[model samples]
Target: MFFILDMFILAGIFGFLYGFLLQKADFCFTASLRDWISVRDSRIGKGVLVLIATAMIGWGIVLTLGLATVGEVWSMPIGFSNLIGGVLFGIGMTIAGSCASGALYRAGMGYIQFWIVIASMMIGNLLFALVYDPWASDYVMEPLQLAEGGFTLFQLNLPFLLIPLVIVALMLFIAFRQFGWSGVWQGAKDSLQDFKGNPFTKSHWDIRFVAVLLGIIATIQFVVMSSISITGPETRIAGVLLSFVFGDDFVYQNTYLNGMFADFPTIGLGPEETLVIFMIVGAFVSAILSKSFRIRKPKLARMPYAVGGGLLMGISSRMAPGCNIANVIPGIGGLSISSLIVVIGMAVGVFIATAYIFKMPLLLFQKMDFDDSGS
Candidate 1:
């Protein structure tokens, strides 16, 4: 049908833009946390916050206009699952040298190591799918939902616009404070100037520029696809592949995998799968065009660490039931309490992992591991 075709086309367009901007900005969640914790450089982390704030503002406006409802808001329990899952995910990303989205983009750039990480991640998901039911029933509490009269920032009686505005102001202050007012103005003026050489090869985009563009793109994604989560496609793909390898009954009989497979309900590719395929293609195109694509092998010393990290990320993502892009981005936009808790847990996980990996004195001092060049 034309409707389905149109959805695929839109998904490709959005996926392309997502891949291109992510590649150009070199925006990896693990790097952002590591840089900030290790070096006191907050540019990348602040850019991520700006992206989240901008998405929140845009989503609010869309809600006010009745253009769309909040879609794909996870109602999982805000308890041990989020805490353990987030910490594991954080540690995993640190080891893997990239988060889920980061791995995808880097894989497109011909990093064979990321390809391995992707494979490990798929296996991890399969493991999670196998164990989710027992784990959820035994450990997870009842799902805490925002839609079912659960607490939310918007419900605090403050003006709805004020929350996002305040968040935006705080994020901007954090982002621009390192550069004095004069420096900020100068940087803006410089960003406006045109490149004198080849646009693709010579030009570099500012983090803020990419963040704003990401916000807009994410908003458009919500309008078109009625959902916005990078991990959804990956998870779905894993389910389909597992089903093929095993039997349909094996996958469908399992509770967690069945829920995932049932969401798509198709033997062929769906919108989420289409988005992921094009996202890789777009990243490949961008890397090639930018002259940055190269087949690089990971350091032998770090292979085990990378595989372990990928496994952790895969299992934790399903346990949390979301990744950074899926939970943090949209969760913050929707003002979910569980999302905030996950972010805190992730930060703690990053801190602990960084201390262990870099061998920092007292676990807080700066000790850069120049020998380890995985990221």
Candidate 2:
């Protein structure tokens, strides 16, 4: 009992840190991709890359110290699952105005729209779990054993230091050309000054600060939790809800759902669920403390889009076997081939959603339609 309590406490601490930093930085994956596509603003995207690079470095150290192994890289067939799932997720995020992590944190900030998204996402998960196998066999190819012959950057035997160094060098080059040394220095100084103020009431941390903190938090999450993801908790919630509605054996009886549970067993509120709950609590507290908490009721017309978006997000996340936070951030950090495939598919999906569905300008320098009042 004491051990369980301690685990919950630790999960809550990590979740709270994740929520607080995410809110302060406004680090929504959807927003990062949209900004880069629409306005050529890559700051948030670069921050994401920084986070991945930092995680890679941290993982390298962990491996060097024999604290962990690289065995966590997901082994799945390289096929249409990634592309289709990623595309769906991208479309869902665009319509919902946030990804899974973004929705969770924003919902904590009292966004009614995100609540709808969450509910719809649960329904999507339940539905997809019911039909995963046929979809997998029809679309996904034969399973590739990553440890045996499957591809991964880590399999290439490259120096562990090379990946992070390359990413950092690219970021520096972009920053130097875009902001210059003086501008960058001034921005850093301003960020420092902002940090010196009362974080609870006066100001929030800068994006760079949030990025570094997220990297460190993710690293710690790996060391402590043995897994890092925001979607796992939602999956547990869906499973529990299904069991309540259908019967206790609902998840265990179903083939796909059973397989899912095999990987992430739902035996009461697990650490992931606890982490998610605390994430919401932490975000709410942060919002209240920052005087930013307010009920953001969506326009009635937008509710349908939110629901549809969320449903798509849920389905795609499950099909891909992970959401952006689960598949993209940690996946990239671990140099998984599946992550690379999913990223490509997501980029394509984002392009289609932004350009065709949302009718946003695809080309850089093109004017963006800021008015989202109409569908």
Error of 2 at 250 (Å): 1.7
Please name the candidate that would achieve the greatest TM-score relative to the true structure: 2
Residues 103-219, candidate 1: write the lDDT tens digits. 888888888898888888888888887776666544452352223332346545555567878887886686478787888778656644534466556325667667778888887
Candidate 2 overall Cα lDDT vs. reference? 0.74
lDDT of 1: 0.73
The regions of model 1 sitting more than 4 angstroms off are 1-3, 70-76, 134-136, 139-159, 173-179, 190-197, 360-375
Q: TM-score for all predictions?
A: 0.87, 0.88
Candidate 1 is scored at a TM of: 0.87
lDDT of 2 by residue, 5-104 (tens): 7788889998898888788777888888887887678878867776777777776666556676656544344556766778888888888889888898
